[model samples]
Target: MTIATRRAQARALFDAGVAAADPVAATTRALVQSPVPATLIIAVGKAARGMAQAAMAACPNVPCLIVTNDENAAPLAGAQVMAAGHPVPDERGARAADMVIAALEGVGAGDHVLVLVSGGGSALLPAPVQGVSLADKAAMNNLLLASGADIMQMNLVRQQLSRLKGGGLLRIAAPASVTALILSDVMGDDLRAVASGPTAAPLGTKAQACNILQSFDIWEKCPRSVRDHLSGVDTATDIPRADNHLIGANPISLRAMAALVPDAHVIADPIEGDVAAAARVICDAAAPGITLWGGETTVHLRGTGRGGRNQELALRIALEARARGWTAGWVCLQGGTDGRDGPTDAAGGLVDSGTLGRIDNVAALLANNDSYAALEQAGDLLITGATGTNVADLGVLIRP
Candidate 1:
């Protein structure tokens, strides 16, 4: 198959994976037989539009409010849609936050709130903590993004800094029955951290959030207001678990991908550890069939390269695949489900036995943290723009 065709097929497989882990669909189906009327639906994340559409299918005529990234706007027709930013908050995100708070305010005791929350909701719904300016939050977010901190740590800080995150939304909508349909993007599926757990119960103590910031050596860098908020915080509230369900996650998505490639060997769901180290493992264990894995990985960011963890993984995998000298058919790929890796437009990169033959100075690329540039030079970067889905990462090794 042509390179384009191969990528198209790979993406189709990825989409099937995403569909398999759609919490909104699962939650809606579960609620279908229940007598409680879902009067208001609040969907938030990159997948918010798709989730809203699915929820609408299950509960026809329910009023819906969708808060998603700017790229996902068109998919949420017929609903009150608000397009916001991702990875970083903007004025639009603040507006969406206001709207969500207002929507919750209107929910009565008899109303049921169906909350569709997934990854990226933290950025799309930015209700800054009192006294903390939006600019301060944005600056802190930038630091966290560049610091190579893991999602959990980053979100811990986020939950502490925002009004809508860490079960705050659930509290606001309390007395009203809430059924959170979570499409988990975090490893281990910590409900309190997924999309900052807008509908789930809170998990950490304020001291825990303070500790995480200190562990990362970022406490001093945080805004004074943020520090004061964390210092004076009384107690971590419990996420309202009276009614909640995590219907989607990396494991479910990875399993679906594995089923599509029936010949493939399925590995662990959230493949953790260092990126380069993980790549070596995949190369060393290559067999005759496909091997699949999923989950987020950290980059550590020692180099000045312009690539995400997925790109870095592919680059390292290419080096190993080349060293094996088993030319031609073996293929290894890694990508984020949201179709954006790090700050680049490319979803990730792919490598094959022939990858080394087309590239020069791979070591320099690795050293400079310039895997994206190197992959582009080698004609290997995978681009899908924004797929409007976020379950985490998908790694595939196909040897035939």
Candidate 2:
């Protein structure tokens, strides 16, 4: 296969993975099996709009509220769509959190609350606990993001500091019947980790959250209010039980990609951890024909340059391929299913054997943690504006 053909095939496989996690289809199917005549619909995350749209269609006349990032914000006929900052908490998200809490408060015992949860929900709904301010939460968020803490660990800490996380929403909507149809962006499908488990159980106690923060050595840098909240004694009562369902996740998307190429090698274990390490795993498993891997990776922000894990992983893979002297035609595509990586507009990067050759200084760029700019110069940045769904990241490699 020619390099061009391989690149196209890689992207096709990646697209298939994304299609499998379509929030609308997933939500519609979930509701069909177990219909929710909801009085209130609350959707939060990158896929919130689509999930809310699907639920609103199923239960017409229901009051719907969607909380999502600015990129995914759009007017929905029957829902109140609020755009909020993602991957980082902001004042807008704080207001949205208040709105969510207020909506939950208004829900009566007889009312059924259909909660659509997806990736980015944690940051999108920063209901800071009593003493903690929104700026504190945002600062903590930046620390976690830059500290290279994995999603789970970061969420464990977030759960302790928020009023609407770690089953806090369930506590708030006590008498109301809450049902969360979750689109799992978490690698292991840990329902609690998805959006910090707003409608699910807490991942662990406040002590554990404190432990994680200290383990990362960022505890000292954390705001005093945050530290106090996590260390404070737990006087809250038990969280009310809710019906939580896993509607979609990364594994499903991986399977979907594998289905497109019957002979493809699907990495059973997700590609996770550091970007360079994850890239090594992908390169090591690159077999002839399509090979697929799915999971989110972490990038330690040592440099001032900008790029997300997916972009860094892609560039790292290209460098790995070059170092390994893989002469045969091959292409690798790594991207976030949400269609945006880090702070950049590009989804991720699609690079081939010749990608390194096209770049002027691959090492300098990688050293600076500027994969987006490097990929841009090489014309390898994969630009797919807001897929309207999030199930972590997906990778596709084609070799001949």
Candidate 3:
């Protein structure tokens, strides 16, 4: 196939992966099969709006509260939609958490709470514990994001600092039966890590949270209040367990992408850890047909350059492909299924063999951690605005 054809096909595959994880469809299906007679619906995450809509359709007249990032927040009838910061905690998220907590007030044994959970919920709903302030939580989040910590590790610490995470929501809604329909953005679909497991079990003890921060070498950099809280915390009581369902996730989307090309190689292992290392692994797996991967990757921010993991991964893959002398004809499209990559407007990048030739001093740019600028110059940045649903990320590479 021509390079252009390959790029197009790769885009198609990625789109298919995203489509497969459609929140409305997934939520609708789950609700139809076993609809929850909810007295209140709380949808939180990137897919909150879509999931809330479906739940409301299934259980009409139900009081609903939707908390999501600005990208996915929208007005819906019979529901209060609140937008908050993502990838970092903010005052707005803190207020939203208060609203969420208040909404759960007086939830009794006869009442049922339907919680729609998805990616970005951790940051979108910031209910910092008493000792920790919102600013402290935000500082810790910034540190964790730049520390190259994986979702699980980041969330393990976040759970300790928040009153709405790590089954804290379930705790607040005690005596009320809670049901959670989760959209898995974490690689392994560990529901507990998704949205910091607001309706699930706590990851570990506060000591474990401290260990994660120390392991990442960001323990000392953490705000003093955060340190004090985690160090002193053992006062949390047992949390109630909710009936959780896996409504959507990354693996399901990855398989959908691979199915588009029957002979395509579907890497069962998710793309994770350091971006450079992940790039090399992907390059090594490249064959003479479409190859697919799913899952989020981490980037240890070295410079002030703007770009998300997907953008950086695409550029790194291009560099790796060239270094391996396998860039004769290849196209790789990597993007977040949610269509918002990091703090940039681009979802990710669709890079081809010629992508390197279009950039100036690719090494310097990569070293500066400026994948967004590099990809933009190459006309490769994949910009798909707020997909309304997130199943982590999807990647497709077509080589001939």
Candidate 4:
């Protein structure tokens, strides 16, 4: 078999995984027979549009608001749609969050607030707590990203700074019956971390947020307002009581993919490690079957690499396969569920042993943080534009 053949098989398995964890279909089915009449639905994140479409199909005529990345605007035709920046807060995201807060204000005691929550919501709906500017939040976020902090730690810092996160949105929808349908991107499906748990119960302490920043050596770079907010001098609002449900996650998606591909092996539902090291493990272990792993990874960003975690993982894995004298008939893929990796337009990369064999300066590319360029030259960058969904990172290794 050729590298192309292996990649094709891996792609099929990945698509199967996504189909199995369809947030829209799953959420719609869950809410179809509920006796409570949903008065308003706010769907926020990469999966917002799909989840909103499903919600509308299940319960027609309900007022709906969909917030997603700017690139996915066309799918949300009938709803009040707000396209915003992601992975970092921008003015547009803050504005959308204000709209969501206003929408919550209209909910009556018995009215239903159906929230479609997923990854990227934290950045998409950036309603900062009083006294924090969008620029301030953006700087903090960038600092965290470059510092190699994990999602859990990053979200803890974000929850403290945002009025819509850390269950603050639940407080805004207080007295109303809130039902949150979540498409989890975080490991363990920690509801409070997914989209910063806008509609879930608050889970972290102020000290925890401060510690995360301190550990990353970013406490000084954080905004003054953010620092004051987490210092406990002023009391922050708490997450309100709401019924939250996790509709989809990496485990579910990886399991679905495993079922589609015979002799499949799941490396780990929550794979974690140094990006390059993890790549070496995958390349060494992949056999004559499909291997799946799902979870977020951290990048230290020492090099000026124009690559995300998934892209870097692919490049590293390809290099490892070459080092082991492995050629053709093996494919490795790493991609983010949100269809964006790092600050690039790529979802991730799909490469083979042949790719490494062709590249002469692989080390230079990796050292320069130019995995995107290297993968592109090797014809291995995976480009799915935007999938309109985010559950985390998905990696597939196939050997034939």
Top-scoring candidate (lDDT): 2
**Two-way lDDT contest, 1 vs 3, winner:** 3
Clashing pairs in 2: none
Q: Of models 2 and 4, which has the larger lDDT?
A: 2
Off by over 4 Å in 2: none
Which structure is stronger by TM-score: 2 or 4? Answer: 2
| Clash count list over all predictions | 5, 0, 0, 3
Q: Candidate 4: RMSD over Cα atoms?
A: 1.9
Write down the RMSD of all candidates, one decimal each.
2.7, 1.1, 1.0, 1.9
Off by over 4 Å in 1: 1-12, 22-28, 31-36, 239-242, 302-305, 323-328
C-alpha lDDT values of all predictions: 0.79, 0.91, 0.90, 0.82
Per-residue error (Å), model 1, residue 53:
1.3
Report the lDDT of model 3 for residue 190: 87
lDDT of 4 by residue, 1-400 (tens): 7666778877777676667667677677667645336789999998888888988877688989999987675555558988998787788888888898999999989798889998889888988777878898898888888898888888887887877888888888888988888899898998989998887755677888888889888888887888888897535555468888778888988888877765787886377767977776776667767778887888887777698999998888777777777646778888887778988999899887678766769899888889898888887888877877788888898766
Per-residue lDDT of candidate 1, residues 14-105 (tens digit):
67776776545655665675533678889999888888887887778888999888767775556888898777899998988998999898
lDDT of 2 by residue, 315-368 (tens): 999888888888768888999999999999999999988888888998898888
Reference-based TM-score of each model? 0.90, 0.98, 0.98, 0.94
